[model samples]
Target: MKQVTEKFRFGIDIGGTGIKAGVVSTENQILGQAYVPTGAERSWQEVVPDIVHAAEEALKDAGEFMENCISVGIGCPGTIDAQTGTVVYSNNLNWQNVPLAQELHRTFTQPVFISNDANCAALGEVCAGAAKGFQNVFMLTLGTGVGSGIIINGRIFEGGGPGGAEFGHTLLVEDGELCTCGRRGCLESYASATALIRQAKRTAKQAPNSLLCTLCKGDLSRMDGRIPFQAARQGDEAGQRVIREYIKHLAAGIANAVNIFRPQAVLLSGGISKEGTYLTDPLTALVAEEVFGKKNSFLPQIRAAELGNTAGMIGAANLSQ
Candidate 1:
């Protein structure tokens, strides 16, 4: 086996819109990166070749050859069978039962590893970003939808199967809003940026005279996560209401996760996390109040993810290490 600190690694992050690849050093440094648009409508056979092209570009940019890489790691969205390096399903890419690692291995002839994209993000943070010293960490990403990653003893924990730590899909309300996963009242339905935008639009509609309506110039479609937070900062009643409720649901989910895993820290990522202390302060208070063992047990520290968009690729690259 090669020492992790003595070799270069290739990391690939597959997303709905694009595929990002990076040549990373053993020191967790990204030497070079490249990206290609994902023609998701095309077959995986076509997509796989594009992925290879992107990797070659990254290696070239890093002034290295494929032979210099010790292994390749892939972070993809879906139920990933890490042991088999297969992607069982990915609604965004319309991929199902794809032998992703095997496909990559055929092209690169290197050891290949695969994992959930969110899990990769958590691992990235743990290895090189915010959770560096923590043995246990939980990460939440509030994007178009909510995504979660859990790390225990510095390793990704996928529960008993391929898809675990799916905090976003956890039920928050009984038969409430419909979720993208065909479930009702999942945490994503209430705590995600999508949910924030929805709440902002509905709030503006209900209170036509509120500042939230004016912020979007009365076009609900123009409303976004920032608008509500901005409006709330300006003392808008409707905006404050929207943010408050959003926090409530988000806190509930965080508390639930804390109660179960009790990690050393909980890191927040994605667009909403940019709110910084405005979001964290309130969230910390709420979680302290709601977490099951808050009064008697040590509480996990909550903070924002430091790596931003690079976490997935960086984490993927380190997987082989």
Candidate 2:
């Protein structure tokens, strides 16, 4: 028999402001990485070249060549027709019905695969991150908007179609705050970092003399997600209220998911998860109270994601497996 050599893979994570690519070994470790600005305002044709460049840079960093790569996987923001490897729509990138996998396949001999960015994150955790040993997991990424990923039986649960598991858009409150999805009271509207900033700003405007307002130097526009947590730690009543309410809403959304999926673990990612115990402690307590039959059933462990932004890239790379 002719001797065979093991090959590496490429994973690309496409975001609104930037793109990331990594060279992944068979052991699931990232050997090298490259990043480039997405410049999402342009058309897909203009961005595709950059995506290819990112992969080239990563391959170079890994001291590997395209001939050695077995496949390429991409995690993109949008509704993806995974079977066809096409992007159905992406509000962040303003792309519609683009043949992404086919386009990438043209640049390299390796086969290409694509999936939703959130789903990729969940898959990454299952592969080597926080949910490494768990078969059932749920993940929430709290950034400009809320992103969610679900895993069941050690596989990505994309629902009936490629882009179906949209937990962020699940309605949490009726006739409440308007969401970016143009809906009222979505979990994203109440639990995202954007929503936290909005709540902090409103609270600051009401209590101008509070520490929360002082943190922004009396300019409400300067308020960000951190300001509320900062003010709360300083024993500022206004900031405390914002944190308390944010936690309550987030817990409600999480508990709702728990009731349905009952996963083994729920991981929190994105910039908000940096709060560590400050965020998870209260969330766990509140979710425990709301979950059905909590006294009789074991509640899922709530944890911060270990891989951070790399989860999407790692997960995307493994999609071909």
**Which 10-residue window of candidate 1 scores lowest in summed lDDT?**
1-10
lDDT of 1 by residue, 174-200 (tens): 998999999999999999899999889
Best by lDDT: 2
Give the 10-residue window scoring lowest on summed lDDT in candidate 2.
Answer: 1-10
Clashes of 1: 0
- Candidate 2 residue 20 Cα shift, in angstroms, is 0.9
The estimated TM-scores of all candidates read 0.96, 0.95
Query: Local error of candidate 2 at 103, Å?
Result: 1.1
Clashing pairs in 2: none
lDDT of 2 by residue, 1-321 (tens): 113434788989999999999998888888889999999999999999999999999987787767889789999998888889999999999999999999988898888989899989998998999999899999999999998999988877877886588899999999999998899999999999999999999888889899999999967888888889989988999999999999999999999999999999999998888888999999999999899997467799999999988999999987853
Please report the TM-score between candidate 1 and the true structure. Answer: 0.96
